[model samples]
Target: MKSLDRKFTLWALAWPIFMELFLQTLLGTVDTLSVSQISDGAVAVVGLSNHLFSAMMTLFMVVASGAGILIAQRIGSQREEDARSLAMLSLKVCGVIGLVLSVFLYTQPGLIAQWLNVPEALIPLAESYIAIAGAGMVFTALSAVLGTALRSTGNTKAPMVVGVVINIVHVALNYAFIFGAFGFPEWGLAGVAVSTLVSKLLGTAILYFIFIEAFHRRIGWKELARYWDRSLLKEVLHIGWPLGINMSAWVLTQLVIYVFLATLGVKELAAKTYMNTLESFCFTLGYAVALALQIQVAHLFGAGRTRDAYKATYKALWIGLAVVTVNALLLFSLGRQLLGIFTDDAQVIAIGISLLGLNLILQPGKMLNMALTNALNAVGDTRYTMVISFVCMWLVATGGSYVLGLHWGWGIVGVYICMIADEYIRGILCLYRWRGQKYLRQAEAEPALGVGLSAREQELVQA
Candidate 1:
């Protein structure tokens, strides 16, 4: 494809996902706002509960993204059967992982909440929310894996549509359940959790039907039982395990930050909660574009078009920077107005606004790190990315947040300053990794093949 054509293709791939993410963000904001009507404590409970959910979702992403890389490469190399088999294996692995996580998280939520130093008053609500949400892990895993499969095959629109519908359902249900509207029993925070679970379950069912009947990509129980390709499984684990660890570390760091914020007292925790919601809105564009580049770059690399992949990455980086810059500026300009939508408390709004100002500097660096890290993973460079992520988040973000924010009495703003420092550090490292062309070597060395393929074909396969 020509440069202009490639840019357009990337945008086409990104925009729908962008809208989907925007809707998802809106859904979150609605959920928070609806719960906020109950009390500030309710919002805090939701935020704390969501930290646990984020960790589980990250684990799911590790497997789904790893499978996506292989699927994209296989499709690029015209290896349809291999791609299908990989998809089946991905489903089975995710299902098993999801089940284990569900049981563990459901049973141990109070321990986890206490570990995070969640407020005593909010702990019960947080625990209840997490336990209910954890029950939907199977649906979450299936939806994520299948969505990634579709994106890998260059069918981004289907996933986007499904995501939109899912969020709509979530928002409607959240409204009904949170307020006892439409004859639904009021469950408050727990109601939000139930709504999310039901939505995900419905989404998984819808996607499964779409994948099997509409797209004709069926993976029966027999295929899942009989297709135990050890080598392929190894390839996925080699790439995915590090990614999982990296994500786990990342989530743990956030939980640690939550612990730190809880010590700062309830107002600070509430401010962080509102800021996180606003930041998600601003960052969605970068996230959407980065996801698009990840799939496109992986496909190009798998097709042996290295130069095209590099060009695509550069294009995506510039686009991500531009998108984030604009959003950051808008958030800064309208900071108070946005916060007002969620809470009437002037103190909370003021604190959230201050957090938004700091986010202006933080968001750009974060966008850089997010784009480069994801693109690198697409080319199977998870090890390096994971190492950098763990070190920066632990040493700079977690450690610095504690020292600057808590130790020195700087409060939540100081914690945010440390977060910005961490983002810049990792962002610079990711840029260097990409510029040094280390990922190119990694991609060339890791050859993917079905155990049944011939040695020569395996070696010569573009992926």
Candidate 2:
């Protein structure tokens, strides 16, 4: 097998991740734009159901994240064969879970939609979208596993290239299907769902082939099934469960708070929807950096470079914070124009303007939290992150939204305030953990994931 051109620099890794995430954000923007053409009600419906579908994706993340972290460690330890086995297990597991979730979402979108307190008029549109887009979860599952595998090995570019293709196909398909151009039937929002399904399937297939070629590995379904290793599964789960639960809690909380905004009325919900789409533009940049930090820190930790790994987290955090601040400001300056691109409602646009200004503070705080959490996750310090996230997401973000936004009559701005507070509080605690060097202690104990170095030796290596 060929050696990977493993340049573990932050920028090298993060740029591709940023481009990939940016393309994904663009796809969401395009989807929202297409749906907006139908009606603001359609936009609200698509946003509501899609958030639910995206929430269910946490299941896929648990397996993929566990395997990806372990794979990075194994690669750092020069155990390629073990990493390959873990990759196969992740693929198999995520595929099975995705199919199960897909069926549930498709079969009972209406039930969940109602439970979410979706407006009665929008319930039918939400059901159609949830059923169609929900079915594509299988493709999304496989792609997550494949993408994580490549990234764990320092090959972020392959997935970014594939994203380019996927987004192009989705945009073209959206035009054809939504407008009945190119001799296709106009199925409105349902057509948008179909386009998403086709694009996801295409991207997943391409990524699978690329993973095989890049890693010089061959896979067969029957062979993978026949050689299922319970022990490997256990190892992955041990490392990943906390991280998964943390993520799941956060997303579910977002869903809950969205319901709070929904109760504020259609205009408030529409503003929230439009604000979310625009916010992703800034969020993706920060998130991409945090993700790259995890990958880099994982390899350093695995290779016994403890001091380097520790420093890498803070270094990436500073850079991420500075870059995201500028990005947030740029987006805020264009907030009204961007809001106008989605709708002509003066009320929704006015509400969105305030939200964008709030996001300037929100994005920086979010970047801080994500960078620290991913750094800890890379070094297997997930339990603390999981605990802090569970507590803060529910109490600070979700619970506070109801109390302040509802009880105190602060409205949507109050929800944003609660969210910002959550981000900063969680981030500060993570920073405190990093300073205490508990992650270092954990690393020294678990030599395989940690850089088997003593405090004294780490200082020398870092020097």
Candidate 3:
């Protein structure tokens, strides 16, 4: 492969990730809009159920994240063969976890609904939706790891294509099943779940094929057995365990916030859901840049170029902030018009507009937090992020939301303030760590891949 300049490579990778995220976000928005047409209560049910789905995705992160870091580092170190092995390992691990969680969540749908404090009227709707959507958890898990693996190898476009396919399939199926169009049965919430599951399953299959090609057909039985090395598992877990814990903690914090919001009323719940979906449109840009930064930072760190890693992070942060700022401005300007697509409720649109205005204030801090945290994690500063996140999220954000939103009767506005506070706090800390040399110590703890690539890989590199 030819070596590309850092700046060119960064955007080359970031754009596809951005589009993939946008399409995925759009997918959820369509689901919300379709269900919104049925009833606001149904919209609330789908929204809350999807939040639970996000929390459940923590399991996929555990394996996908660990494997992703290692894969990037291995590619950086020019250990292509080992990277292939790690990709295969990540897929197997995520697939198994997905299967188990799918069964667990699907069978205990009511449990999940109850856990979220779904209203009595909405409980059945949420349960029925989650029960069917829960099976897609497996596809989600596998697709996440597969996409990450491909991205680690700098094949981000493949995942973007797969996402396009998912969007197309999901929208078509949703239209047909949602209203019984073209002779299809009207399944309502269940129909929405079917669209999600079928699209994810198909997308997962596509990603699997792409992973096989990207990794040089490395998923065969003999190759899988060969790649399942105990040491690789240990290395992956070393990096992924902290990330998974951190992600789970964050998910729990969000769920707690949702619990607080749910107490307000279903209208608040629906508003929060719309806010989240729309917020994704802006945050996706920041997250895309951050994710690209992670791969670049990991590659630099793997090559022992710590200073370049820092430079890459700062550069990515600037780009992320700019993109996010533009997105925020667009969202702020058109918040009402855009939100009105999901529902005709003037009140919901008003609340959502206010939330988007708050998001403009939230964007810069969020951009920094997203970029720097991912850069920190890429270089093995995972534990610091995990610990600080746990502390700030629960102590500051979670606790503040309850005191401000519920206790003070400030409602969703109070929760947004808490969220903004946490983002800035974490963002400042991450910035401090990036600017200083304290995080360098963690680099010494990274996995060693010896001096150079194998002769076969070396020959391929020379060729």
Candidate 4:
């Protein structure tokens, strides 16, 4: 049977993706845990550097996201060759973009440290970490695109396997480098950076081969070298540009919020850092399910099964809500213990527990937003979602965070109120959008997939 003909439940698709994201989240958590052994300054350095690293990743997000959406739809429609071509195009685009941005990070690390308002004592550590870790962006982009390609084709297991390997390598190397174990010299935060970069590069290499062997079978080297489908590339960028912009906008606003948090002092910064690591458990689960929904929805659309697409969206939403709610409750109950895993500081743990209390209310809205936004984007309604995200993220989340947290002296708790507001406000809009079926109408109204498979795709739709 064709891959597309294979039936899938929400869990069948989501669990592997969830495990992959869960391991990915664990990778960051491990980094934080390892770095915490050194000093609060080291933890702060890693945290600040990661903020910049995430923002710089906008380049990969656009291409990977766009390619994933397109490939899913193509594969859903049974245009395997077209899907393969798109997978290659996305890698080619993100590879060059990633390398160029990597160069920027290597050269201008201090600028980012300053931009984040890194405390004076931690500036050197933050700058060095970013420079070293940023070198891995190219590898990271390649691996991410490969993973996205695999997931789009309903091969989520491959990426999950790759993630497991990546995290294992990262953890082992982190232990050796951070503590100078096994005769390795202790390099502190620098060691953490080197371990992370090397592990990511390894993961990228593994995923690259998996992607080619799985998707590029029997295509000659000459054929591969000669094929550069400009139109497909253009279509990918057309779909990806808004997503890239949306991500960049969100990152910039987050950077601004970090600056506001910085004004509150180092302890608050550390508290926020620890809080984020804990919250990742909830958000990442929601994200994993939402991504699965996007793929499933795209497949349904590709098959011209519009009603099933709607059915799948609501089904995925409820699944995500259930998971996020349970996650929130668990985190709330174990807040102190979880926060203590990162630091022994009572004050930081106290701040984090209070913040998790806020997540009780925030997680549900966030889960909804994650599901609906990706559902919208998968159906090619990216522009509307981007616009709404931009407005709500800035006006409500960013601005309100500053006013409530800093000005009101409510600190992290107040900032969280703004965050909950942002999630629900935009989430409601996304739900309404999906319920109204605006994204479906827009996707159907668009021109057909035009990547040389137009005729065949049209036939598939007609049949």
Top TM-score model: 2
State the TM-score for model 4. 0.94
What lDDT tens digits, residue by residue, belong to model 1 across residues 331-356? 99998998998898988888887787
Candidate 3 C-alpha error for residue 122, in Å: 1.0
Model 3 poorest 10 in a row by lDDT: 446-455
Task: Single out the weakest 10-residue window by summed lDDT for candidate 1.
Answer: 447-456
Task: Estimate TM-scores for all models.
Answer: 0.93, 0.94, 0.93, 0.94
lDDT of each: 0.81, 0.87, 0.84, 0.83
Scored by lDDT, model 1 comes in at: 0.81
Among residues 3 or more apart in sequence or in different chains, the pairs in candidate 1 whose N, CA or C atoms overlap within 3 Å are none
Candidate 2 regions exceeding 4 Å error are 1-5, 445-463
- Across 1-463, the per-residue lDDT of candidate 3 in tens digits comes to 2354453378888999999998988998888888888899998888777768878899779878988987887888777888888888888888888999899888999988888898998888888898999888999898999899899888889999998999999999999998999899999888999988999999988887777778654467667655666667777888888899889889889888988888998788889988888888988988999999998888777666676777778889998899899999999998888888888888888788778879998988889888989999987778989988999999889999999999998999999999999999999998888788665554444324332233344456557
The model with the greatest lDDT is: 2
Question: Where does model 4 exceed 4 Å of error?
Answer: 1-4, 216-226, 442-463
Candidates' RMSD to native: 3.1, 4.5, 4.2, 3.1
- Residue-level lDDT of model 4, residues 110-137, one tens digit each, is 9878878888888889888999998888
True-vs-predicted CA distance for residue 446, candidate 2, Å: 6.5
